[model samples]
Target: MSEIIRRDPRREWIARNRLHPDHASVLAALGVNRGGAAVSEWLGPHGVVRKNPHAIGFIGPNDVKRIDRSGFQQGGQSAATTPVAQDSRRTVTIDQPAFLVAVVPDLTGGRLSAHDKDLLGLARRVADADADQPGAVVAILFGEHKGEGDGELKEQALGDAGIDRVVHLNDEFYAGFAPEARLAALSAVEREMMPRFWLLPDSPLGGADLGRRLALRLGERAATGVWQVEADNEASLGWRCTARGGAGSLDIQRPLPRVALALAECAEPVDETRHAAEQLTLAASIPTTLSRIEDLGQVAVDPAGVALAEAEFILSGGNGVKEWGAFHHAAKVLGATEGASRVAVDDGFMARDRQVGATGTWVTARVYMAVGISGAIQHLQGIQRCDKVVAINLDPGCDIIKRADLAVIGDSTQILAALVTMVEQQRGGQRDAA
Candidate 1:
């Protein structure tokens, strides 16, 4: 008999740490909008037709049943393995209102039990979709069993939906520790579970940290910028991501349950399925220490009113702008926000959010006219989403022309002056007519 491994990396992770599912929080580390949504388009094999569920997080310790060892503490005066709540660590009733469709690995009396009360509705929604079939079930997978029979009951939930099977794994599930070692196990579980859907978080909790860790756990490609998950079609289970910081939309595919992490970007997380019982389960398994109390209570900062989302026309000043006042002048002329070349920002003429480069935001405004901007690939990747781009530069050999929707061949400073004067003249004529 294979006894469960308590020291498993995944088990250790499940016991400690939590996944951040917001995207905005992830972007904040690099300085982005507090509420702004930066999208990462495609990183995996683009145009590759997939056949698996497309969901992120419909599962957690909450989706299971466990012992109520709530008072247990690390190195406390209490016994090391003391069970406080007499009712804790009891046999879970799958048919009961409390444990329907939840995952409890400790059902047989040894492991973790998690109850995701919040996901009750979501689980029922998924289960109901496949409930018509008795034996067929959606696979609810986890990296470890913390004595909650949640995994076991999830495997038996036939009435709730299809049969719910849980793969009680004890491996590299914890995100903080080394996670590269369990990719194979994750892949193997996913293959067997064959989930029809995948649900994920829509916050700043960047999944990349988990994905990179997951890539180590599962030997497969991991793409970032995922928001929504659909479980209907097996061939089309993936995410609907906004590429280039809301520049455009990207459809990404990842392994079902194989892609688990937090969304730190403040992006709205959506769930098509969760049942009442699921919510009850969350109530049972959720640790009190895992609330958002530690976060900055309520400090809001209004970003520079210049918004890329609503801007119909945009003007960018690059290093070629030469001076800070000149860069300000160009931005003022267009009545647009000031963007910068990476060099200009580093030189202190502009701020980072205004910087354009590969690691920056992607732009796709109607008209994006650049002045004194040398389009480098890093910069190009950001603005490549622009609908129509016009690059004004003295150097015709610049790469902007190759990728721009329209390239203007001239000195940025000279061309800008002429264009502004022409606009002013036109405006004056209109004023005279009035």
Candidate 2:
């Protein structure tokens, strides 16, 4: 004979109602404790519903435990227990400073570059060393702030980067590659403000040239290729610095100089403090100097011809790519430097120089686009410094999709062709309008 299963409506109701007095007993009788799993909610001994937070969420594939506050795991949970997030940075305003730690950032493309932010962080360290009489971090900016359209937002970015004061030189004379005029402006700054520590990012984008020229003009020995700085009582400037010398093969330790050109990632970018980036004006007019070098403006260069390490935009392909010509054409249309995975290089589809990974050259491109690439650990490490990553692949589960800011799951050839057509149409429209 078949087992006769009779359902008690009242007992079923009690089992479903977690807040009921006999809910636990009813669930036990039905041989089900919240559907055979101890998750989020259960009836307590005294009829109170108890929540087990640990059992609510599972660990992700990345080995990190994630708590789903959306109630999908537990069914209709409230977020009332969640704590409010608050800003951790302290707001500081330095009205009267003992001295100024001047920073001349590269400010490539009218905005503060990563190298520039790192230099500011170093300057903040120097300025804040003496707690009793703190020195202000003064940034001398050349040309106009062009990246952010809103003026206040641009100034706020500088303030957030720990700049106490800003000296903006937007004169046409200071624009482009007028080293003589720029040197004269620095000379004027030297005579007037007389900053204690002059810091600059030792980058190819104008900072290195200006910093060396400033040191020479001021007749002070500048520490070039500085990567580390620490406080020392015995030092003349109350600090010591370790700099790379002999073409980055030797480490030279010496007393910190008044002028120092620091390498990228020398110090972490400032994020814990908001400063008053007050605008400063020169007391006296900057003296006019004869420019021996004339500004001819920038010459056109092929995107593919650019070195991988210096290229601002990169389009990389991998073994999954079938149409190499389409990939190259997309890169050309998008004005991106061509890069390739190690497998592609091994397969003779790409050059050894075009390979991107830990074994290959490390790139700091503003935008990195990977097509048909299942990202390896080495390749991901190489593009770690990239600002944005775009990935196109047939497999949605590929490792490249995880790291990409934007991922498109489609055929690489089709996507590249579509992108090329869109860019060409846009260019044609622009030309017609012009």
Task: Report the number of the highest-TM-score candidate.
Answer: 2
What C-alpha lDDT do the candidate models reach, one value each?
0.44, 0.87
User: In model 2, where do residues sit more than 4 Å from their true spots?
Assistant: 1-75, 144-153, 171-173, 233-236, 248-253, 287-290, 343-348, 359-361, 429-434
Question: Which tens-of-lDDT digit does each residue in 141-179 have in candidate 1?
Answer: 334433323754543332232223344444333222322
RMSD list, candidates in order: 28.4, 11.2
Q: What TM-score fits each model?
A: 0.31, 0.74
Query: Any residue pairs clashing in model 2, and if so which?
Result: none
List, residue by residue over 1-434, the lDDT tens digit for candidate 2.
76874557677667667699987777778664444454345445455656767655556657766677764453332322333467789999999999999999888878898889999999999999889999999999999875455878777899999999999999998888988998898889989999999999998758799999999988889999999999999999899999999998999999999999999999999999999999999999998978889999988789878999989999999988998988888888898999999999999999999999899979989899999899999999999999889999999998889999999999889989998999999999999999
lDDT of 1: 0.44
TM-score of 1: 0.31
